[model samples]
Target: MVTSYVDEATGLLREDGKGSAQFEEVVLHPRVTVADASMAEAARAAHATAHDWCFIARSVNFPVRHEATVAVG
Candidate 1:
């Protein structure tokens, strides 16, 4: 499962009378369920690779953080 958290703050209004907003922070929470506990490391590695390849993560100017968790079931 993957969850995205974005923090935004309102910016100064423009002369056109429009409100502006900017992203302050972005956090991704990825929960990986593996068949075995030994796969935890592999799952984490995969998550890292995916993060690196993500277009949104790369396009954003602000930092994108990850809070990943692995569980065995």
Candidate 2:
């Protein structure tokens, strides 16, 4: 989701404004699966750790955060 500020006179988004027409907050919902139910906790931890190592997330300037969930079946 994003929040943008528009120029009412020009009827255009203010690119230079504080909250310009840009992707401000990006939420990532990553779903992980584990073979064993007992390993669910480990899978969650790994997912969390993986974010720091992710190239795409690291390359982005804006906030690329997540609300992750784990499942086992």
Question: Top model by lDDT, which number?
Answer: 1
> Model 2, residue 35: displacement in angstroms?
2.2
Q: List the residue pairs that clash in candidate 1.
A: none
Tens-digit per-residue lDDT, 1-73, candidate 2: 1122121111222265765575555666666665667877877687688778979778866667757777775
Per-residue lDDT for 19-71 in model 1, tens only?
A: 65566667777666777777778888987888789898799777777777777
Q: What lDDT score goes with residue 36 in model 1?
A: 72
**Per-residue lDDT for 14 in model 2?**
29
Model 2 worst lDDT window (10 residues) = 1-10
Give the C-alpha lDDT of model 1.
0.66
Off by over 4 Å in 1: 1-18
Taking every candidate in turn, the Cα RMSD to the unseen true structure, in Å, is: 6.5, 11.9
